[model samples]
Target: MNVRQIDPKQRGFLIVNSHPAGSAETVRRMWEQIPCRTDGSGPVVLLLGHSAGYGLATLLTGLRRHGIRGVGVAFEGAETERRTATAGWYRTAAADSLAQGAGHDFVFVNTDAFSKAGKHEVLALVEERFGKVDHLIYSLAAPRRTDPETGTVYHSVIKPLGEPYEAPALDFSGDVPKVGRVYLEPADDEERHATEQVMGGADWRLWVEALAGRGLLADGFTTVALTYIGSDLTAPIYRQGTIGGAKENLEQTAADLAAVLGDGGRAYTAVAGAAVTQASSAIPSIALYTAFLRTVLGDGFRTTVEQAGELWDQLTGAVPLVLDEQGRIRLDGWELDGQVQDRVRELWADPEAGLERARAGADWFMEQIRELYGWGVDGVDYGRPVETTVPWPTPGVSHA
Candidate 1:
């Protein structure tokens, strides 16, 4: 199936498009590229938030590269009439594609990771089926989270920390730039806790504890979480921002999880460079930074699939470790490059420089942003009508 035709008028982030067949085909191709494991024993990988963008691409790469058989979970439902298409459909198509091509079992869980019951159900499924998972990847990024116990929902906000800062945001519909402040209502204490609860480590701990309790962790099993370390310019809006706070907590959780893994197991945090992920697009300042990063990184930039491949290699010991001066894994070294950050800071200082020294860079950056939504993508035929319906995997189907 060809990529779905996107309407030119949609303004906000377009994470989910109606492209079940295209997504399935993408997954099929990814499965073909995975190298077979030499040990003759397949790995079981559990991927959370495996529906769109980086998470989706990571799942595809893991299944393809490591010869892993596993389950994927996403909170979105199938055929929801919401602004974005249901993630359930994409997960179903992805699982079907993997099952058909790799002969591996692919299960999709349709529950929000924020809920206690949802977390429990996922653990129970893993216990009942795989018994233990070899690797766990947490790639969840949500704006708000609801406490199942308290029935209180927490909404996230993006606002200026010190003073009102005006940044250029793309008016996707008008295809023009309008200066706007990243302002939203301040989050209350409950909201902050809820956001932390939803986006933070409670669920991650639950997954690890449940699996550990069941004796599922194989010797040398690894858990990895994706994170970012944007420059100081974007730090308040990002790294130290509310979402940044959540990410910091996530990093701490990774360290804690490492201790829980004992000697044989490991937990790591990969500071991935900026890309057009579903979650990143929602942040106010990220788009501009992403555009700049794309320009500087150029065509050499890795897709989420490529990043996932690197992540899997690191986790499985296929790739040698490369540690930064700080001793953390350096997947996002390109972003932290002195020259790249200097140039970005200059652009941030003078917006007109975005128009000056980097015309090709600006154009390339904008193109990458457009391509995030499957629009202006190279080599795909947009004029062709494609089938929307693809087979969905049953909830409890097991490969083992």
Candidate 2:
């Protein structure tokens, strides 16, 4: 099927495409791209959350750079009220781009991961289609979820402690930049747990167990979960904060998954460097930090695509995995470089001075942010309107 010919308005089917010949060719090309390690054979890789940011980039790198043609499972809700049209559109576009670029088949599943039955369905599909999966990448970031245990749905909110905390907001309403203080309210306990359920390791563990139960995990298969360890300055709002706890749980879950994989399989937590993704933009203090980090680091920060390429290189036996003092894979080494962190510390010590420097450096930082959204990605035709169907997997939708 011609992926580019897909309809843009269709949103209820989990986009599934069959490319037997193309997928076989992709496998052959991957053999040529990946360097042989005397130790073992290459296995098929499956990627979750394969439509955005790191997940999408990883899918691209694994295919275009490593020659690994694998399946991508992206879940989209059936009802318009349950899903955002904007997100569905972007994901479909990304999936189309990936399938077209790599010449591999992609299966989109439209189901909520918060339920046990939904999880089982995805596992079944993977087993029936791929048979075995060599590598798994989990990268889901959502704001709210319904607690299966309590039967209560929680919605997340971005608020501050005590009376609404107000901060200077940038006005993009005019040609010239104007600033105003924006008020934020604090989030409640239920809201916090809902965020955790949606973003945390519960679904990750489910995916691992489901795959293993189906006997789809190849021996020595590797699974990775992306995480972060921000500085103490943002701890109250980030690391130690609500989302912070979830990230910690995710790391711990990775360790548990490793044990489950036994001696042959391994699990890694890649402490990825900060990059502007659609999800990251929603965080309160992250934009300011990212703006500052970009200003200070200039071209040092790696793009999501670059990071994914590096990750694929390491996973494919091209580069030796580097671990930090904490024993976690150091994918975000640039973020923790002593020199860089020291400068960040200096800026944190004096907010006024830091803001001055960041504002002065805004141009370079803005450019980097724009490039991250595929604005300046070389060889991409941004002017042309690309179309793809939203692969919303309804039970009645035919697989073929």
Candidate 3:
């Protein structure tokens, strides 16, 4: 083990190091926040891309609230002698430790979830140990994906499809962060197709098919892909962009997956609200939008953990599973509320001025960014020497 005092180095939206102590504490806080635990029994879940964002939230919510035991597949860098592990890597380790202490079965696979070998490895594990996967959560997000069968690499772009988009964007790449206007060129047919191939539902569908073909999926199997549909303010660069084209394909894929699941099974896209996630932070105007959102939503803003818990309740019949007119699960209702949008519009009209009024929100947004990388959590000893090469608890099928 290598021990050193590590401090985060930020370049743009990226944080180079993660604090293990703080990461563990963040996991603990989320775990402890659950109002109550169930009978210590629930579904055997299989989560893909479950190391951060909505994926991580779903994993924790399942483990703590419903007593789920399962496998997670994600692409993460293990801690090395020269550098610290990624935030998700540390977060997974913390989750494994906690789950073990609580007597729950959880395993992590550190490999490329987008590859064929990765899929086969997970299938073999399920066949050998976990006989049935009751719930499959597809939370994978990536900028590029290579088709295992064809060797064709597709890269996703965030440009609008038909017309150019111009918006005020937030920047965290410098000592003094500021908001500035950004212009994006439109995507051509090929680029649109590539983006859809990378971020869309094809891979999601492939995973489900593979599991079902091997008889690994349980009866009445449930699957959901986490997604986002920002308000009209971000429609040009988001909901109406190339990414939107991908999301539309994803939603359609969900329907197709449901058909494959047959009568008893279910599959849908769970549209979640905007928050400060690594993926969202990389988007052009999201940082600005979320800062204002946090300000306007105030106490109403729901964290990914909270949203995951609600989704779990609906999935387990603990509460009503609400669906919108499109037959997709709607978790972004609060973010899209008429009153909420009205207030957000007041701020969106002029972000520079809006940010001044929403300073609290802006500050909260910045803190969330720090917290994601395990740097800004409360009660963590930054001065203490911490282990950077902490081993993953269970070695899954793939070698990290």
Candidate 4:
């Protein structure tokens, strides 16, 4: 794994192809030079909610080197909601011109995955083009979800369980960033129920059933949904709060759906570690914890891409997939190590010490947020006119 950060236009957020050693272009060259098999032994992975999420990065870093087909779904929001017009524009560029620059078999579905029409579009593409999807990875996080049956929409909230919870938060969203103890109260009954209904496995089941009905799933297929369970500090807001109930629902849904997919198919909900994500930064306590963790732990921070690569290795390892007592894939095991936890707890117990140590941590975390949108990458010359679009390479010019 490359620990040193490369240019964003080269390998980071911007991800423009520079045709360097070990780059996607180099990988393609090796494939052709070695006279390798055109068809690889890898499975076809379909990712939903990829553009601004982790699933895409996870799978891409793991599978892109192999000559496997890839499919993704993401929407560009009008004003930076989930996918923005700019997001669609640039992501489409990366998918075509950079990441899949070698003319690899890749497809990008730019639409709303939550809607029936969008789901149908996904199904139609798979049936017509790919035929069978080997793995289905769902990593979507939307603010609101409309009940498929009742048609009543429910929005998710990120508040504590009982009394108001106070935690030190770094607000870089303001003109000047500052850390302060912000207070947030618990959610009402409606908010709690709605959060569970939406973020839970209800949607996962719906998506799987849809694909299964159409025979789009490959035999011996495995599906996985991402979840999170942090340290005890954020329990009231994350694990024990409304989102926690929703997560419990998600785990249960995964179990039920896995059983339903009994034809050699498996489904699992894996707990992911806290890192800099568009969604995590919105959550009150998680952001603070991540900053503090980074402060104490050095560049021990692993982005979605690194986490996914680690996960892929475990999934395709020599032995069977291991699970915790609760039958859950404990991907966050490293993050919750006893030693790391003890140190973080020690700092949490003393805010004076915490702030003193984590003074630069929150600021560093904020810098990571900039990388998400291609701002903080090196070697990206803004002085030059930006090339915002490109048709995918093919018979036109193979980076291969």
Candidate 5:
């Protein structure tokens, strides 16, 4: 099967295909960004859904900065003869290559993290390979989840909670980009519950319990589930919506998990900053907000990898962990700055001017979206053909 260059195009909030070389280069560059190296003697970490985005960021930080040998679980599609693989697939492949080159012990388990079988497989691997897990980071991002026990499917929604919400949304799927108002109806009870089921802490709890039951949790074990609580500007569609309800559930779950762990063990909900991620790029409300946010922050804007490095420093005691009233790690201080919010509000109040201001950084934002799918990356010629069937170097055992 011949695999050629994929011209990633925006369709609504999703990008179409991926480029292998671009993804490898992206990972290589991210690896170079962390100049400080470790002796591969750090904690053994387990990261869920760590193919791309924040999960990937944390995984790289632990491996590069802390010299942690670890395993990552993610669900990514492989490329076929007619179509390219998912961007995350290529990214994982690239990460594996980098790890091997650096003589780091890293593995990628490509499977459904929500499945009981998948959990069992990973647990067994950990027992055989790492003996115990020092830290578990839950950063899974999926549209839906299937209960391992009952096989019930739950789908997450992004609608508001009680009332219909309308906000400025950005559209870059067409030739001419535009910013316009988008109206969304509130989520029904079923949808909200389903969203919580999919995005909440239930699965996180299960994983922790399963690990503990198997005697796989290390002494002083700790866990953190990544979350976001954006500013009021995105409250209607984000923090005050179904997603917010799910996050609340996640945080509560963290508390419960911490209680069960007892004796020096801890659990936390890490509040992360918003950025141009594959998931957020699909949400028009978030897209519009981030565009303006990038405009306002300018050189101050921190990428996901940068934030992950900070989080690693905080979590590992290299620096103090800043927690808010909720007892969760706060990494979104810059985005929530009062002065920054005031400026974003000024832009939001006037869509025309906001779009104009955001336009100056539109190239950057769009390039981010493209880079998510391994397109629009520098030092790579998109016109050249690339191998699509790049194999995952350290694929883990599959229960099925």
Candidate 6:
């Protein structure tokens, strides 16, 4: 794993896959576990938020295996132990790419692109280096935020839009997580707009315009931003909530950006399957949904890496990416299959059925959450001391 310097002051940081600490045999084991596709420079890709466990990191690795040389992200928030662990995961991906001799180079800029200045810096960095990228993959989530341009902050609400929607929520305080119908508050007009402003496609549009205006887009450049639309179980706060409105706006942005991409380049809102991530766990009712999903799908519950591999296949002409009637990419096919949803809804409908299944399988969901936080790696010895510091410079200013 390697990182490139994107700026002189170090306000931007990039961290990739890491090399081993012990014997050469250990290195070999690490490589053995990592996935590397045979050969192909698939694309020069710019990722806005490619970090571990949320799909982008694995997507980059998969593309490198298929011959994607340049990969980078204009990322934010890399200070905690969790982000550091993810940096190590990225390092492993890079190591695997090189070991396969696929000729891979990745970019990771640790800076927020929500602000006007941040977007300019990002575009400059891309224009100066990668020139024009073949694809742009953006997968990001945050709470309340404002447009840096207007200096008007908008807060994202987790509440339902019209009426309070209740669903079985995952309660984690116990030794064994339990699920029961939980009611969430409703959102007002202002709250709904706030959710859209913060979680919506406005920031995504900013990034795309920045890259495209600066002539940083390759011919047929494709861009995608990940979204989620859970079953009726999460409809209130997810599929039909204020957050869902933001997703709709995001999809609309996809349509608009697709027009701008023009020559074979398309924009898509790739709705992903349910899985635990730094972003999703914080949302209400998702943990419960994921636990039931694990019970129903078993081995079919996809991690970000697996889903990303499929996405690369679709994008690189290896396979066709099926779309919904609305034309957006439907990556959540497996999860949203009628049969699967039927069973999931059944579990939700029957309290006893849902609780029993959750009791059996909720541990998997919880463990995956721990893994996202850097707890479940094979070689990691929590008993030992490890470095938690990063070499990159951070924005010295404090957040108010």
Candidate 2, residue 207: the lDDT equals: 76
Q: lDDT tens string, model 6, 1-400?
A: 3332221111101123221222122333434544766554456777666554444444444544565644444353333432342433434334444434544444455666577776777667667756788877887666756688789978787888889877667776756566555687798998888888888888888888777778787888888888888787777778788889999999999989888778768899887778776677777878877778888898887756667777777777789887888877776888888999898888877755686866766887766555444444466554554444344322222111
Give the lDDT ranking, best first.
3, 5, 4, 1, 6, 2
Task: Give the Å shift of residue 132 in candidate 3.
Answer: 1.3
lDDT of 4 at 33: 32
RMSD of 2: 7.5
The 0-to-1 C-alpha lDDT of every candidate, in the order given, reads: 0.65, 0.60, 0.86, 0.66, 0.85, 0.65
* Residue-pair clashes, model 6: 15
lDDT of 4 by residue, 60-169 (tens): 55445444565677765332222223343344445545444444666777777877888888788777767888888888888888876677888988876776777766
RMSD list, candidates in order: 3.7, 7.5, 2.3, 7.0, 2.4, 7.7
Clashing pairs in 1: 34-64, 34-65
* Pairs in clash, predicted candidate 5: none
Better of 1 and 4 by TM-score: 1
As for lDDT, the candidate ahead, 1 or 4, is 4
State TM-scores per candidate: 0.84, 0.73, 0.96, 0.82, 0.96, 0.82
lDDT for each residue of candidate 5 in 1-400, tens digit (9 for 90 to 100) = 5656567655755767788888888888888888556887788899998999899888877888898876899999987766788889999988887777677787888888899889998888888888889899999999999988899999998899899998788877677568877898999999999999999999999999999999989988889999999989898788889999999999999999989898868899999998888877766488778888889999899888899998898888899989999899999999999999999889889976788878866667878888877887899998987778887656553211
Angstrom error at residue 317, model 1: 1.2
Candidate 6, position 303, lDDT: 59
In model 2, the Cα lDDT at residue 384 comes to: 55
The sequence of per-residue lDDT tens digits that candidate 1 reaches over residues 107-155 is: 7787887677787787777778777788888887777767666877777
Record all residue pairs in model 2 with backbone atoms less than 3 Å apart, i.e. clashing: 13-391, 13-392, 14-391, 14-392, 14-393, 15-391, 30-67, 159-185, 160-185, 220-264
Winner on lDDT between 2 and 3 is: 3
- After superposition, the stretches of candidate 6 with alpha carbons farther than 4 Å from their true spots are 1-35, 38-40, 74-103, 392-400
